[model samples]
Target: MKVIVIATAMFLAGAASVQAADKVTFQMDWLPGGDKAAIFVCLERGFCEDAGLDVSLETGRGSSESLTKLATGSSDIGNADIGALMAARVTENLPVTAVMSYYNQGPHAFFTLRGNGIEKFADVKGKHLVTSPFTSSNVYLPLVLNDNGLTMDDITLTKTDPGALNPMLVTGRTDAVISWITDVTRYTRQVEDAGREMIVLPWADAGLVMYSGTIVASDKFLAERPDVARRFVAALLESVKYMRENPQDAAQAVNDAVPELDHPTAMGSLQDAIGLIFNEVTERDGLGAFEPERLKATWDRVAAAQGLDADALDPESVVNRNFMPEN
Candidate 1:
């Protein structure tokens, strides 16, 4: 199997020689970093080339922003939170659909410095917490708080800017900050720079289990250029598999493409991110394949967290699995 994968990668690496590539613009959910390594690996390692795709990377502010771009046909495909897609689909009737399951588990978590009072999810009670107002994690904050036997009133919460969340945590301006676990390495380095240790309390550990990052495409992009979408997904899936097996190479790909991003931090971020993509849920459902029960479960959680009517939209309608490689 290993030999077959290597041969396939090698074969794809040489594919750009055979044909004219299809240009596909890939919108990002956030700035380039280690957690975003799969796309970089796909581009840097020539997986996109092998699949006859010319993928262009675009920076985005948040999932909702990216989804808006995708729905409006400003972008072809991109990564966004599936829950955001779910809620957006129900309320706004956005013409965007999730094409692949990238992070099978929720990436929301609380980051706090060691000396601070927060040591566990329950420890957050009576503490002041900060989060970027635009993050999709904010929608589920109440559910997580309620699950830990607390409520929004139990903790003093502040909506800080994304760039300031970590600096404030390291400076002790707030007891903790809500961010995705994918930022673990980047945040850990920052905390170390401030001469303080950091501790992370994952919300999933506190009973918030659901899908998070996923590959979504514009409805028109999928409808008008089905073959191009198929090729991009194939390349992306291969890139994801290769990234998991070679974190160092994956990190290097991110750094080599984005020169300002240091290699060590990128490597650490990729390692932390791999935990989200390849885990117990992935073990049961396989890569890029969304299981029916889990789909229902994710929608149930998203609906409960965002206070949406579950009956308004079918969970399956938000995703289309026809592009998963026919193994």
Candidate 2:
């Protein structure tokens, strides 16, 4: 009789423990690819499970769409551009906040053929530029041009589908295409296949410095499940550290998670992604840490571009550092 009672109590406790694992629906800022290997690494390695989270990932179309899902509470957490999130907050009064910054330097860039005679920023004048309406780079295009003594009037802007940008550029339909630097491998391969050499001009080099690829959560989620949020952040940071140490293995993990992803392309993308993930700022402050001054600068740029008052919204209101893991 005593043994039976003990066994029953143990079984109940085990069931309760299983039930207590928090379910986290994570949404990416864009389609799944090599750039998203860290999330897959954490999921496949059981890091999220170890942290008491049962996490799932969903592909997103763009930062604005991802932020919209988060703001509407349709998704628990998302990876998006901090600038886009700030714009949404200012423009729409969304109740979402960025908890972790993975990309200290934004990946936004403009790519063109080396033979296009566009060796410098000034060379872009009167050139036809192709970009998707929803790309983060497009959001900052005005600011990037203005900082370089140019404006929208100086260039020909062609809004097209994201898939068409690469094809249009390779076929000589456009002079340049704006996209994230992580896609350099994809774009480079296409340009090379078309017998052209690609030249990349990152926004950071053009003086449009900002944060990209941030982990965000809706205000409701943070307010109600702060513990789960911290655990998720810790697991994510752990995966990031793991990827930094073993990039090849991280790439393999992503390929394993998404079989359709090409290994070589994924590896190339991961290599480019690592450059943006860890920088002098990340080394000094720690992973996922955001400098207040940097955040303020980003806010100012976004406000200037979007025609919003910089003082209308506080940076602290958009960023919540409480969920970052303790080093």
Candidate 3:
């Protein structure tokens, strides 16, 4: 896939038709992908504009960088896993708070080849595992390892780039790599084209539950620009709704934003993303409803893994549901 230049005429027409509003900068956790459909959807479907927000969604190198950008005020808003924020708070006391979680369930996982003989979590013991060395992965891997009666010392943990995970596994450099279930859809074609089979070990399967792709803002900005932040979250929830109801349209919207996504891959990715984002939410309390019990549970898990006291902190330490959509 290649980046395409969207016609300036359309943007110009849209700009001409809409009045200028408070501009908000949104930094993504990574480059445009299926997990980021809500951001692109908000832009493509004019949800941000309708909410009186002039949103600029920029690509980030990773969660660490995105969080840094948020903390340093380089961006007004950002998206990342809640665990990422927790680790940051512990490591450096970064005052970032999740406003509303997009994916209530964590999607990150250990991906492997089906025929590679890694059919279960127990098989991960003593295996050569490739993973991001960031705090989020650092905390998650050990938790998973401990859950399976193993520790980090039991496996061969190699520090690798997120993009290099599949190649390392395919070439026998690593047995498995940390990834998101979204990878199955986005990189499936590339993995197949490389003649490799793929299998996903979802975190959900291993009793590892956490929030993924949450919209967060630094405390300073949330206090200074609460109106804009609230509008951003409101638009974000609307975008989530769009992705859930009209997945094909959401896919096309994401393809429009990313441009490198070809038609076939984009369609398949849209379907996969729908499953990733829309699961359980529609049947329950709907999108962007921050569940206090789930938030507390995730916090306790992270605290236990990090050897911190969960009782010392409150839900306010991790989440701020003040901006979530009304039930």
Instruction: Return the top candidate by TM-score.
Output: 2
- Runs in model 1 deviating more than 4 A are 1-19
Q: Assess candidate 1 and give its TM-score to the true structure.
A: 0.91
Candidate 3 local Cα displacement, residue 155, angstroms: 2.6
- Name the candidate, 1 or 3, with the larger lDDT value: 1
Per-model TM values vs. the true structure: 0.91, 0.92, 0.83
Model 3 poorest ten-residue lDDT run: 1-10
Count of backbone clashes, every candidate in sequence: 0, 0, 0
Evaluate all candidate structures by whole-model CA lDDT and list the values in order: 0.91, 0.87, 0.76
Best by lDDT: 1
**lDDT digits (tens) for residues 1-327 of candidate 3:** 122235566677678767558888998988776557778889999998889887888788778899999999888888877777877787788878888777777766888877777899888877888886663656767787777788888888888666787777777787888876666766566668778878788877787766666788988889998888888888888888887787778878888877897545656655665665666753575666667777777887878877887766675677887876566
Decoy 2 TM-score against native: 0.92
lDDT accuracy of residue 38 in candidate 2: 88
Poorest 10 consecutive residues by lDDT, candidate 1:
12-21
